[model samples]
Target: MRELTRDDVNAAVKGGSVFASGGGGWVDHGLEIGHAALSIGRPKLLSVDELPDDAIILTCTAIGAPAGRDWQMLGKDYIKAVQLIIENYDGKIAGVMTPQNGMSSTINGWLPAAALGLAVIDATGDIRAHPTGKMGSLGLASSIDYETIQAVAGGKPEIGSYMELVVKGTPARTSNILRTASDMAGGFIAAARHPLPIKHIKKHAAIGGISIAIELGRVIMEAEPDGPEAVLEAVVHKTNGRILGRGTVTTKNVHYSGAFDVGTIEVSIPNRRLTLHVMNEYMAVGDDEGTRLTTFPDVITTFDLKKGLPVSVGDVEEGMEIAVFAIDKSKVPLSSSVKDPTVYPEVEEMLGIDLQSYAFDKEKTIYA
Candidate 1:
């Protein structure tokens, strides 16, 4: 176990932004929570091996659409979410883990760990940012007998949006309810849920995912002084990813629907058009001829060529020159949650594209 420092926080925001795929959380929000955690108290990070196998670890996360205009989640909201879990649950909670690697999601557990004296476990529900809570449930969604207990807190209290809810039900049903609560509570909220044994987390989660984000952030930061090209090159080399396309975004069609931003983006290259399907994050990339270049579970991120920073789907605008980078699913360390076939149907249905064919095909190549 080690105490987290400011540098670690910076690295996490930078690296987690890339792994966020498209949408995880905002960079500013991530930095705010991370720095605040450091100031409040020393936030310690521990590997799963350091904890007892039977120890219960809780998941802390933010749920809602990134494009929401009224979204307001404070640092206290995160801690309150965890506190609600502690107040209601019967088990002795040993640590906190995040659902996925995102700008803010990567450090979601830091504040709670710092203030509550809970260890921050270096594991993730999904290595990359995904749309729904079920995708980050670490395959608990597939278990018929497993019940999920989730607590949420956030929103603008002055505007009658602030709410706190604790619910126990099936993972899917409870997750949907939380999404609804997110919409009611100003389109974004902090959540703490699904306390599980360390042993189960060890087997199902993306182990050491936080460290991966930090290292990737370090790589990007170190290369920033060189130029955008250097930053892009460094990221591609670090992730074993390749630039799928580099061009100006010709058209962007994103809109808020339910609890997600669903739309598509078309980029015009020299001779090819790269289309991106979105449901909160970039779900899939395809060529002009309709050949899928990359699918979800694989890392699909866009970089602002001018700034050399990973750009979220919401930040993309028509005529902005960006480069789409993709890492094959086989290249990244995936959790059991992303590998579970059960999670793909919701995303597939939402985006109207087939992900299971590529996500699970062992013989499938990025260009195949």
Candidate 2:
């Protein structure tokens, strides 16, 4: 067992989440609360390689309305979600993993593993953050109607409700229900209940996201005392990512609906500029010249002007000075879900896209 640091949390959050393709919850929320959990008690990072071949590796994901509800995810609510998963399934929990890259899902990824003495494999679905429920992931492929999945929450007596997300299959869609449960309870619920043994981890899943979050956090910490330039350089150097463009947020359009803080952000620096379309999470990022700077699965992180720390997606307002950086393309693959194309169309479609077409190699890509 080892103590997790702010760096480890940040690196994993930033690195894994970018693969979310605008789905995972949010990067900042995960890093902040996950760090808090560690501060209270050292959170352990388990290597999948260490687990027994027969160990069951369950991907604990979060199904929720708002992607940035980490603040409300306190105390036993997290554990309750875990309990639900364990209780619902007959398999023994030997390890933990994440479906989405953001806070709601990833926290339990590392948390359940450390708290329960289980290996936490560094694998996930969406790299950045996405608004759709867990079933919408590459894991489900668009095959499973997003509504048919399950949604769970630990509010007011571990409440659960079902909706007819699908006329057939797991109707009431417990997956989507989880998100609503979190909204009603003021937090998020755990998901990706299907369990797999350690052997499947090596065969699928992103191998090393925890280390990436750590490195990303280190860059932020180093830049906090220095300057944005220093932080920018740190991120670029450490992750081998790129500073697509740097400028002040000139315009911000925000609205609150259905647990999502959807909006648009425009950043202007000197003669260059960029614009980001954000749903509950940051979606498409492009520039005025029609040059789309980023694609799905690669997280686009934004920071405040004064403090170098990351700003939560909920707190982002109009005229907020910020810096947007693209995370390394070393994103975790959706292979686990890839097997079930009916549910994981997004994962399969993107899998066929070939990263080489995007000019991002397997190693890393960093440009300023």
Candidate 3:
């Protein structure tokens, strides 16, 4: 176990933003949570092996869009969400883990852990930000009998109203309900759900994910003095990822459908064109040659050419030059949901892409 320092927090914001792909919460909000947690209490990072197998664990995360202008979340909302979950849970919670790594999601469990005096498990449901809750529900995608209880809190405080919601049901049903709540509560909200034993987390969660992000961020920060190219090289070396392509954004079409922001980004090179699909986060990428280069479960991120920082889809506009990176799934510690074929059908159906056909060999296709 290690105590997180200010450097860890800054690096997380940088690296977490990259891992967010396109859809994690805001970076400023993440900083607030990280700084506050480190201020009042020392946030310790514990690996799953350090805890007893019988220990109870819960996934703490924020739901909704970073671009949701109406969405308002406060520090109290994050703590309140977990407190509500503990109130209903019959078991004694041992620790809290993040659903995914993002600018804010990386720090999602910290505030609650500090306030409630619980350990922050160094693991995540998914290494990258995703739209649906089931995408990060560990291995519960195939567990039809599994029922989860979730608590949500956050809303437009400017309107003088903040709402709290609690629901118990199958992961899919509850996830959809939470998405709807996000729409009604403004746009974004704090959430806690998908409780499991430490044993289950050990079997399905991405072990040592937080540490990986922190270390990767630290490496990138250390390389920054050498230049953006050096930073990019460090990331590729760290994750075995490669730069798929680099070009200016020729076109971008993004639409917010109350709950999710679904869209596509098109980039043009001299002889190649790259197209990306987004549903909160980048899901798939294809080229003008009619080849599906990458898909979910693998890391797909874009960096602005000028600033060299990871750029979210919502933050991108037409004519912005960006570099695209694609990492092999094998290089990263993946949660079970990412490997399960069932969790992907909906995204495939929505985007109309055959992810299964490319799930294994597509990395070779990109490298070729």
Candidate 4:
């Protein structure tokens, strides 16, 4: 296990921003939470094999968009959310893991772990940012026997939108409740839920997920001195990612609603155009030929042409020169939900577009 440093946090944010796919949590919130974790204690990164198979692990994440108002996710709330889950579980709680990687989601376990003196397991529900809790629940989505225990704390009561919620039920039921609470809380909220054994994590979760983000972040940072193109190359080389298109942003239309920021982005190349479908994050990328270049489960990131830094969908705007990058799903670690057909319908219905054509192979398993 290794302790996280400020430099590590900076690198993770840069890398996390890319994996965030266009949305995760806010970059500013990620910085604040990361710094706070480092300051209070040593947040240790642990591999799945390091922990006992019988130990219990809970997922800590920020549920909501950064665009809304009246929702205050205080630093203390992260810890409180975890504490609530610990109280609910009558067994030993060994560590915490992130549901997915994002600007803030990547660091979701840091503050709670540091405050509670728990290990930050180097595994994730999903390698990239996803919209719903079920999408990051490993394969627990179909497990009717896996009882879910959830705890949520966020929102400011002054505006009639503050709540500290806890629920016990099926994974789907509990997940929906939290999403609704987040929407009612203005836009987002602090959430902790899903208790699983180390054995289960080792079998289904993406191992070394945090380390991958850190390495990718470090590579991007190291290339910064050279130039944006070098930084772009480093990003692609490290993840074996592909550059879909490079051009100025011609149109960006995204709106925050129902605790999710959804929309589309259009990039104009010299002779071709690239379009990105967004649902909190860039879910799919397609060209003028109607061929889907990349889809969900794979990482779809946009880099600022001048800054050479990864940018999110919530932050992208028209007239900005940017480059769209994609790493095939086959090359990246993915959760079982990525292959689950049930999760795609909501996103497709929201954007009114079909994405099943680009879905990842369902036959693959982490244990394999």
* Least accurate 10 contiguous residues by lDDT in model 4: 359-368
Candidate 2 stretches greater than 4 Å from native? 1-43, 65-71, 103-106, 134-138, 142-151, 156-174, 190-192, 328-368
Best by lDDT: 1
lDDT of 1 at 341: 89
Residue lDDT tens for model 3, 1-368: 88888898888887888788887877898899999988888878899999999999989998886566688888888889999989998889989999899877888988888888889999999998887788899989667699899999999767954789999988888888998898888778899998899999989999888888888788888988888788888888887888888889999987887677877899996689999988889888889888778877778899887777788888888999998888777788889878777777777776667776666564444541
Q: After superposition, how far is residue 94 of candidate 2 from its true place, in Å?
A: 0.8
Query: Candidates 2 and 4: which is better by lDDT?
Result: 4
> Weakest 10 consecutive residues, lDDT, candidate 1?
359-368
- Ordered by lDDT, highest first, the candidates read 1, 4, 3, 2
Candidate number that wins on lDDT, 2 or 3? 3
Q: lDDT per model, in order?
A: 0.92, 0.54, 0.85, 0.85
Model 1 per-residue lDDT tens digits across residues 77-165: 99999999999998899999999998789999999999999999999999999999988998897777998789999999899999999
* Structure candidate 4, residue pairs in collision: 22-313
lDDT, candidate 4, at 207: 80
Listing every candidate in turn, what is its Cα RMSD in Å to the true structure after a full C-alpha superposition?
1.0, 6.0, 1.6, 3.2
Q: After superposition, how far is residue 119 of candidate 3 from its true place, in Å?
A: 0.5
lDDT of 2 by residue, 1-368 (tens): 45566657765565444334334556555765677666656666676677777887665666554543432444344545555657666568776666555543456566655455555665554434556544334344343443222324344434442221111134225444544655555444444454556776666555554554555555556665787567657666765666666567778775654455566777886687787766666655667776656644456667565765445556566677777767644443334442333443432242233223233343333233
Could you give candidate 4's per-residue lDDT for residues 1-368 as a string of tens digits? Answer: 88888988987887888888878887888999999999899988889999889989999998987667657898888998999988878887889999899988899989999999999999989899988888888788767898889999888878878788899999888998999999898888999998889999998888888888888898988999999999998988999887888899998888887988788889999888888998888888887877677778878889899998888887788999999988878888876767777777878999888777657442331110
